[model samples]
Target: MIWNLGSINADNFYDLPHLPGPGETLTATRFRQGLGGKGANMSVAAARAGARVMHIGATGADGRWAAQRLFEYGVDIPHVAEVDSATGHANIHIDPQGENSIVIFAGANADIDEQMIGAALSEARPGDTLLLQNETSGQVYAAKTAKALGLRLIYAAAPFSAAAVAAILEDIDILVLNAVEAGQLHAATGRELDALPVGDVIVTLGSDGCKWISNTARTTRLFPAFPVVPVDTTGAGDTFTGYLASALDRSLPMPQAITLASRAGALMVTRRGTADVIPDLREVQDHDFG
Candidate 1:
């Protein structure tokens, strides 16, 4: 089982010819609304990849529909609570090149408390996986609780907060970050990727692929990305992280897990939309990359 203590957001997407500059106003070529948030995206990805995933977070009255969508995607949501605040949301602007810029409102996502974290984690057993991101509150508490409970804790250090990473670093078994985030972490900690104390560290290099460093083995390996022209790169990283965790939970070797995740992420970028667009396990298996 995978327990995701993450955020749920209503994603608003705008297709644009190019990203707008500061103080610039441009009309969108297209607009669409869907479910999003790193947490929600990862949960859906994991579930679709054949893992039993339970999403633990809070949503406002307005966000119930988003939570319902998670259920439709086969993610367990028994611990998602209702809060008084508005649901979190993101405004994503995608340029013709598939590059994106986002503005996020961390509304009810910020309402997660220690009590909620504890309650959700209490349902998890030893050997279960706990996945986290920087979007929601109570992450530090969740890390500590999951560590104490003997769960395999995985942290995706995105939106790259030095302080948040420092706080939870010692507790996480695996740490995943993108190229930009890896640079930020190196700057913050004054150490390179291999020097991080975590057992495993993965640096995702979007089109070039990903690198995996095993701290315990003192070795590094690179996995190249599948070539494709992306339609919208919105949730590609989340898809990778989710699929990686799901593969690991199923007892696949690290190399195999990374390969499967890479395939999933590559497929994700070829499509549009967020959580709804992640590829299923069968689609991944049946894909002919030749």
Candidate 2:
């Protein structure tokens, strides 16, 4: 099972012709509400990719709907707790060009405590992949504990935080992030990507491709993404990271796993909405990884 320890939010999205500048108000043509949050998004993506996933996070009193939404995606919500607050919400703007700008209200997500973390880890065991993001502040330590309990830890170091970045250097099986995230870590530690003091790092470069140091074989390689017209790139990174975990869980070799991940990311950009847009294993198999 894949365990996702992060935040869950109810998202409100508006479609504008273009993004507005700071303090500027713009009219939008359409509006929609759905499930969102780093953890929720990645959980749905992984579940859609055919992993049996468990999502652990908090939902607001009124926001408990987030759990229902995640359940619709086949994600287990046994550890999703509801507190005396509104479920966290994201105010998002997606322009005609598919660029997105979002403002988040953490609500119940911000109330997650260490006790919640312990209860969540109680459900995991060795070899199960614990997929974590930066939404929850203290969840990093719980990830380490899961690792100690034999879980293979795969972290997506997004929206980098100082403490989280510092914690990532210890015993992570796979550290996944975008190019900017990769640069941030490299800059912070002043170490070559190859010399980073972790198990392995995968730096995703959007349309350009991805770079990584192989954990098993210890080889550095780069893979270019297959060209496609991207309709919305919102969850491409999540798709890649989730599929990468799924591949590793299935015991695929590194090169084949990267290919699966790259193809999954490429497929995600060809659609809209993070929840329903993720590609399935068959779709990934059909994609040409050229």
Which of the numbered candidates is closest to the native, going by highest TM-score? 1
**What is the C-alpha lDDT profile of model 1 across 74-113, one tens digit per residue?**
9998999999999999998999987889899999999999
Task: Give candidate 2 regions above 4 Å deviation.
Answer: 16-29, 94-100, 215-217, 288-290
Report the Cα RMSD per candidate: 2.2, 2.3
Model 2 residue 36 distance off true place after TM-score fit, in angstroms: 1.6
- Candidate 1: the clashing residue pairs are none
Q: Which 10 residues in a row give candidate 2 its minimum summed lDDT? A: 136-145
Model 2 over residues 1-290: C-alpha lDDT tens digits? 88888778878989998999979988989999987788888888778778899888888778767799889889999888888877888898999977788898878877777788788888787788888888865566676678788988888888776578786667677888898888788778777767766677899999998987865566889999978898888889988988888788777877788888899899899988886667888888887745
lDDT of each: 0.94, 0.82
For residue 257, give model 1's deviation from the true position in Å: 0.5
